[model samples]
Target: MLNMRTKAVWGLLALALSAGSVQAAEPEVTDARLSLLPGDSPGAGYFNITNTSDEPLTLVGAESAAFHMTEMHVSTTENDMARMESVEKVDVAPGESFAFAPKGYHLMFMHRAEPLEQGDEVDVLLHFENQPELPVTFTVVAPGSM
Candidate 1:
């Protein structure tokens, strides 16, 4: 009851989906998640990075087409005052966890790259000092999200 052309089309689609699933489970990328704020006017981005490999990892830097400049920042507090400072690298030990959040380690987007509507997405690539850059597609979310 099925035509040859139709079966071929279905096979192609299934192959494509399978390839994507394999890439998602690739070894290079371990645990990674990112979230952003709403009404983007100089808003920050949060990333939770987990190294599943046996070696250590150092976050070299980040870049985004959406922003004029992207930098890795670390927050500090002294005498009830808090400030952020740009850093060259962030480290993660084997099987360790690193967090980039408000009032802590985070990424600063100098300018809005794309529309900040919910469900919108941005392609951001993160480079590790010793590892190859990993490109991630992040979905835009409202402020104070997971």
Candidate 2:
């Protein structure tokens, strides 16, 4: 036996709480950077992605305004030789973090439209399998700095 006004108030409160929880469950990206070479060579990007929610997060692809193509790659050494391979997706477990570093998981930026110099910033968008597109800015750094 609840009044109409009381029911409306309760409904609004529930909606607000749900919205807050959704925001809190989103993943976080940090320490993003793009390595700049001296010439028109392909650059690499690194970052740390942290999943804060209970569910796993999957990154399917990435896009950048400075390059024609962005791809995920991983470096491995076999028989004393190092090689890189393209990766389709990367997964992060709940409450865990995925690191993109030198000689590890990284993003390959190819076919650059313009030259990138040190201290420049590039805007990149990360596509997720289940989450919304996350926008990130990567600072251009030297090749050896990781």
Candidate 3:
């Protein structure tokens, strides 16, 4: 009986340790918004994501039913000219945060499937490397609001 008790204790301890080692908090997203342009122009998405987990996270891309194609982009200036370039991935270290804002890292939502108006809510699924996709709700706003 004593031997059985010792084995059970050891098993419980191992289980607890494993659980503690692998435990991580979910990533937090805030201020998610999508700026829509008139006509067939591509929309822009902005948000702030905080990595609350124990490991690093990489943002790969995004998808939304409102748009046919969503891509990650970064805006920069060179020789007094503004330039926007596509980015494949963005890494955020543990306890760090990344912002998708105007004039910086942002999402380019192209080819709208349907007409969207101001105050409408858009559902965007953010893809990450080695992590499950994160669903975020973005409120549509006018381009001038950004």
Q: Write the per-residue lDDT of candidate 2 for residues 1-146, one digit (tens) a residue.
A: 46988999999999999988765477899999999787878999999999998988999999998999999999999999999999999999999999999999999999998878999999999999988899999999999786
Clashing pairs in 3: none
Superior by TM-score: candidate 1 or candidate 2: 2
Best by TM-score: 3
- Candidate 3 per-residue lDDT, tens place, 1-146, comes to 99999999999999999988974677899999999988989999999999999799999999999899999999998999999999999999999999999999999999999999999999999999989899999999998998
| Clash count, one per candidate | 1, 0, 0
- Model 3, clash count? 0
Question: Which one wins on lDDT?
Answer: 3
* lDDT comparing candidate 2 with the true structure: 0.93
TM-score of 1: 0.70
Clashing pairs in 2: none
For model 1, residues 1-146, the per-residue Cα lDDT tens digits are 46988999999999999988752221244323345555557656676788877777888788889767888888899999988899999888887788786678877767776666666777778888757688876666666665
Q: Give residue 97's error in model 2 in angstroms.
A: 0.4
Candidate 1 displacement at residue 89 in angstroms: 0.5
lDDT of 3 at 70: 96
